[model samples]
Target: MTPVPTAPLVRWYRTSLAGHPDGLNFRRLWVGDTFSQFGTQVGLIVLPLLAVSVLGADEFEMGLLATFETLAFLVIGLPAGAWVDRMRKREVLVVADLVRGLALLTLPAAWLLETLTFPLVLVVAAVVGVATVFFDVAYQSYLPSLVPSERISEGNAKLQVSQSVAQIAGPGLGGVLVRALGAPLVVLLDALSYFASVLFLLRIRHREGPIRRSGRRLHSEIGEGLAFVFREPLLRRIVATTALGNLAGSVTNSMLVLYAIRDLGIGETGLGLALSVGAVGGLAGALLAEPLLKRVGEGRTIALALLPALPMYVLVPLAEGHPGQAAVTMIATSMAITGVGVVVYNVAQVSFRQRLCPRPLLGRMNASVRFVVWGTMPVGAFLGGVIGSRFGVLTALWVGVAGQALAVLPVLLSPLVRMRDLPRGLDQHA
Candidate 1:
């Protein structure tokens, strides 16, 4: 793919308040993402309810469902980055939203027709997963185009706030809707949210010039992305830490709903409430991200954010020994701390990468990082299923917690711990 112009990425501005040129465009992206993420949170709650409560899916099936939702990242992650780089990113974002919206409609249709099955659910999950691959790569790549390089951290923080708010409310809303409308009908809300996202995206005025075509082989383009990520020492350590965290998180997530419902005896409402309460920490984290970066510097923020939260994951399995309401409280508390750590860490690391990569390589670079970090999820989900099926859900949770504790080691041991601030741009690193 021919590289997009880099001027906008380096463009400086005196202000980025709401009425400013950059601010308006960033708001469009932010609003659309907020809707999309809200729907995703709803689906996160409702989909498992559909499979577990409605279809009576076993632990392995639940794991399979989780696996399929993330499988596209491992399968097409590299190539999708190459493709996104070759296209207009706004168009890619719109098309991905359309695909996910349309695909989600099938779940409701099948349920209404009395043909809903685990396989059908898996298929829809996979389709959504595929669209998500393009959207995520393009979304990260596109952000620098809309904001000043100096304020990229602020931009990321704003977006994280949107997601955190959505996470806090989406689950509780979904649970209430599930009780009133049934799980199948509740999925329609997610589909409609995607359509709403499309509308928000359409109103954005910022436009990329026509992409220049290139004769590069697909594999070569993919390889370049991989090499860039793995070659940079900072990028390499970030990727290792993030990949390990994701792997461990996915393992715990794979069985969390089932365990909450079965062993902990929390109903859908209780489970949703627990998750909703937990997400309050994400909101707190998002609000704190920029301030933390300013106060502590990016490197320390990244290295230390997870230290408190990850160790708290052990509280999840220990919840198994508590009574129902007590267990829910424990789970919520654990998740809340985890949320704070994750948001702060992501804001620092993501802003670092965005500022560090050259404009032309942004898509590939983000994709490569995602390919490693997110690619581990499917494997972790499957392993969680196998372990949950054989030993118990509590045992799987313990294993996941152990992995999470170990995930922070790479970044802590690196030179990042010694730095007060990170390099501002690729030129600084070069």
Candidate 2:
């Protein structure tokens, strides 16, 4: 097949805005997501600052927080999938947003009352974490029903761009908020963002189809999803590669802020600025991903994206003393690679799964795959802290680089890297 011509990804954004009949609803949803993303970015920055600045948390406490937040995915992902499959996904999404908003509100309230404690932070984090898992699962399943298959990549690209823009702006805004209003108060803004998201979702007039439910027991239904993922050749390879990559990514992510403060001798504001700059690369990468995928093929494109991180990961630890310049370079390069890789990988993986998995099984299949792939995150986060404390932050970074670099081996060995085209059906071997 002749390679599809590359076009500027911004064109996809323009088309997404103008092409759909429910253009207003789509715009509302996108705007809502952008606002929610902005708020979430605030929490991501402020929460850690709270631990380090107010609670005097060490590496272990930070790691524990990370672990607690993600642990629910291991326990609840499968069942959540089963439950969501039987309900209106939009309703689930709305409710999840509200729940998260309420949970975040507690932090600011407690702070105002002078009752905020480390335990309170932990509880709130866990609650938000649970809500996040539900929202993510439903959101992924809900998108296919909203847009056509050929447009899925484009639609997702728009969302990714929104997120990248938030990442670029949010942390800096968060840092200022934390500095001016305090960490706890910063969370209130996030809460309000979620509320805004709920309002936007309510305005969406596009009705979704009835939810698919299996009369089988929950456990049995969960098993069916798992069976589909493991039995499919393409899914199996993607899962393996993703699980390994996540393990590495989580390790690095868990320590990045802490490393920046202690090892790199950077303050919170400087760290935020660096991260914000890096998100620019992420924005560029997300914009370019579809064109890259079309030209190189999904498998080869993914493999090439994976290789860029090897050098970038190594540079992260070496970025000491020269905090501003080193951080800007490190974050920008890292985000660029991650943004592109995630967009391309998700487009191929999601489209493949949707095309092959029976519509009835879509929810469960997503949940099962998530349980296996995302379940490793908490483990990686915990291990990262333990390793960082014992071996030093720089050494821990090296380990992360090694693990992430080696993760590409699975894709390299699988038919995923060599296959010229995505399989037409679940049963077709790659």
Best by TM-score: 1
What is the Cα-based TM-score of model 2?
0.91
Which window of 10 residues has the lowest lDDT sum in candidate 2? 421-430
lDDT of each: 0.89, 0.76
Give per-model TM-scores: 0.95, 0.91
Q: Per-residue alpha-carbon lDDT of model 1 for 53-136, expressed as tens digits?
A: 899988899889999999999999999888999999999999999999999999999988999999999999999999999999
Tens-place lDDT digits, model 2, residues 1-430: 9967657565654566534555666666677777778877777888888877777777777777777777778879899888888978788889988998999899888878989888888888888888888887887777766766566566677777888898889888877777787777778888998998898888777787765655679999888889989998767877887888778877877787788766666667777787787677667766886787688776666555566555666667667555576665766566656555665666666666766776667788888888888998888888888887788666767778788877877667777677656755443231
Q: After superposition, how far is residue 39 of candidate 2 from its true place, in Å?
A: 2.3
Deviating ranges (above 4 Å) for candidate 2: 1-18, 22-24, 321-325, 425-430
- Model 2 has a clash total of 0
